[model samples]
Target: MSNTLRISLIAVASAAVLAACGGSDDRNDGYTPPPAQPPVLNVTKVDGRYHHNKSQQDSGFRAMSDMPPSASPAAEIALPALDAQAQTKAQGDSLGGPILIALPQTVAQAQTAEQLASLLHWRQDAQGQQVAALRVQAADALGIRLGLLVQALPDAALLRFYPDSKTAQGYETTGAEINAVLRLNAQAGEQGQAARTWWSPDLGGDAITLEIVLPASAAAEALQLALPSISRRFVDTDSDAALQAPPAQRAGLSKERIPSAGSCNLDMSCYSNGSAERDAVARMSFVRDGKGYFCTGTLLNDAIQSDIPYFITAHHCISSQTVAGSLQTDWFFRTASCGSPYLDARRTTRTRGARLLYTSNVGQGFDATLLALNDAAPPGTYLAGWDARLNNSIQKVLSLHHPNGALGKISGGETQNYANCDGRHCRAATDGRGRYYEVRWGDGTTEGGSSGSALFTQSGHVIGTLHGGTASCSAPDEPDFYGRLDLAFESGLKNFLAAAQRPF
Candidate 1:
């Protein structure tokens, strides 16, 4: 793509000068001159370190290999106890937490933004690519425990953060702990070319800090600073749930920690086929009414080719608009090595919210929900293609998902004949009971976090999203069900997913 910005001011000035000459015949020569072209502002791809910190941390940072030994109590802290209502009242009616500030776009603000970028101590990966970093301190001068929120300029393609070296070594942190205290970054999504807003985790003390990172391609003028409530910082890990570790205490899954018989480990290479299908899968984490939960989803490619960040997941997982808005999405969370012991923790990308577009429950015979993410997927992320044609069934089927919100996992199976359940047959569900594709897995299995995962055909096109199933590692022969994509398309999804306009 060309990085040119055209300005026509020079042409206008020349025209004014010509008019001031009073149309002299000697200079006119009875001929009209061609219009002058506009001046283009050249944009260059920048790569290097940029931040406000003097130096970068070399050690003490926790990587993805540090997952918890076991699940913890889910309700460690109650939602109401976070004092959300009190904080909101104190902020005087602002909904984006206690602190929210619009980013400055003036030339003066751009200069300061550039200065801050220059302060960043950039570091390079093994591939020699530079990454910008900023150390975010959790506490302010007043000793108040708070989480800061900031809106980025509209040119940031991708951004993420991790525990700075000093903070990482202070305690045995888990992935949950890192997520709880420092929510990190947000990047451009499918709908927009860049991200507009971001927030920090609410940490009540000096115990939590982070080093925010962004791609060198980001424009310095786009960075903005913001601060929000302490409650915004917590991951909402209530103790009643099965997964227990705090967000900060966990990391990516290592080889030994991968489930032996149940969920397929993301480290397994069989799941990845180098297609957009692999990149389209994402793990979904959400907090509603002070409780956190996990599910899976896929980025769907639509007819307009707008890259609008349209997403599909199980209606059972998120049927309400409120829960949909509260969602937090993670992308590219798989391992670099097929059977390696460690996953590169730094590669994962995240966003905090989305908009609900459509939804239906199992009783309605079309258990599915469609969403348009508030933020676009990061650069290089995929928007998966779909096949919503009724009566189309492939011999082999596959699924990629996050089981228990752990890591990306793949499952494969053979499609048996369509089975009728709740009075609907496969490939036909309207007015009848819901129809679904039945499959018997060849290996691996799905779990709690796997809900809403996309079911793909052998050719890589998505056919449906997981609805419910009895199949598991302990019961390998049992069958699993997926809501038919054709049904979803006919019911209203066609208006968005279909490439051609067709009346419903």
Candidate 2:
């Protein structure tokens, strides 16, 4: 059959499949179908470093003196302790695989920018620029993330967040960028409670200082920065305790010293033969509804083999650009070496934020979300190959994911059958029209943070993304369902994955 005719048939079949699956057919219901072909993307390669908006090397504060004086301390607030037993129970009960890590706390004085400005300590930096800083301390907390409601911010203003000790490692952004993200969130129909709030990246430590630097010509009175609430992470997924040890001492510590996946979970480093495939996977942590969560995602190579940082994950994890804009990924988040439990302390590269390209939920027949990162992928990271053809005969499969927000783990399995899954239950698609690939694991199992991880064929080409199922260490014989990537490609992924022209 001619290529044109083949595509036409597939399109008709896809429409029928959606209708059979009870998906919305009404165009007015806010469901937009993918275009026939992928649009050409204009991409420029970067220096392979994580530069979100501005350079990370740029320190807004020149020295400790640049910060506000201790006498005029910003409003101090302490978050309530999260219940350890409750957190464990919540993890066991999570069916869709998003591990909760933080609790939202309301700040009484953050009702408006005017109210917040009164709490900040205003000073003049060495550069003679107007600077105002607020220090929020959550004693004994693992991480702190702020939610800012940008009402009126000056274009010349710059915002930076970092630990009190680490001045250079701060994450910086501009008021203009925050406003732009808020506008994008509004356009995407994200008008929830956290709609106008732009979440800051997880600044590791108990206390974080938010500093705003205004141009010499700009007036601080014109600035508007409101903090309605903040999220305090009680878990230590990005713990740096291991780094405090001497290099030789860290190398000799036993696996028992580090927190990791279950004993049955296989380390991805053990199977380093597929280094490219391993590099393609990343541990993803994102914020939604003022809470922090974890999942997995993969970097995908398009048909033209362009390195555009196109990413794939389950739609259930992230279906909106607003959440996508809060994405932060840990590259090379595996062990230090094969069979070792020590995390690679040297691999500290983390890319922050993304732009949601396309997404389809389980109700739409398959679960998948495509994203374009705000910054370039880390150096040496590989873009994974994919197989978009629907073929149930393909048997052997593999998966690499971060279980319970720990180091990467590998699972080997085979496709058993097609099924329609709602995370809790699954029914066999007797007519062979199911949207998910049901697989029973033989080597390892998945956990709460493993959702959206890729299910790859033996050839290292991804065929599906994990949605959820009962498969675990306790029930190795039970099946796990992955939303078929072929179905996702047919629905809308083709617009980004099936491009013909090479990236410039």
TM, every model: 0.51, 0.81
Model 2 spans with C-alpha error above 4 angstroms: 1-75, 82-95, 164-169, 236-259, 349-351, 501-504
lDDT of 2 by residue, 1-504 (tens): 101000010000111111001111111122333334446433211112222222242222233434344332455555555577866675444434476677666777777887898887777777778877787876667778888887778877888776665332457778777777777677666676566788887756777877788888888788877888888777655443232223553433222222356667777777743456877788888887677778889888776555678888877677777788778888777766764545665344453577777777775457778888766776667788788777678487888888877777888878877888653456668798798887767777887778889988777788898877766777666677788888877776776777556322
Task: Report the Cα lDDT for residue 480, model 2.
Answer: 72
Instruction: Please give the CA lDDT of all the candidate structures.
Output: 0.46, 0.67
Whole-model lDDT, candidate 2? 0.67
Best candidate according to lDDT? 2
TM-score of 1: 0.51
- Candidate 1's residue-wise lDDT over 33-105, tens digit each? 1123222212111111111222322222234234121121111111122344544453342221111111111
lDDT, candidate 1, residue 449?
68
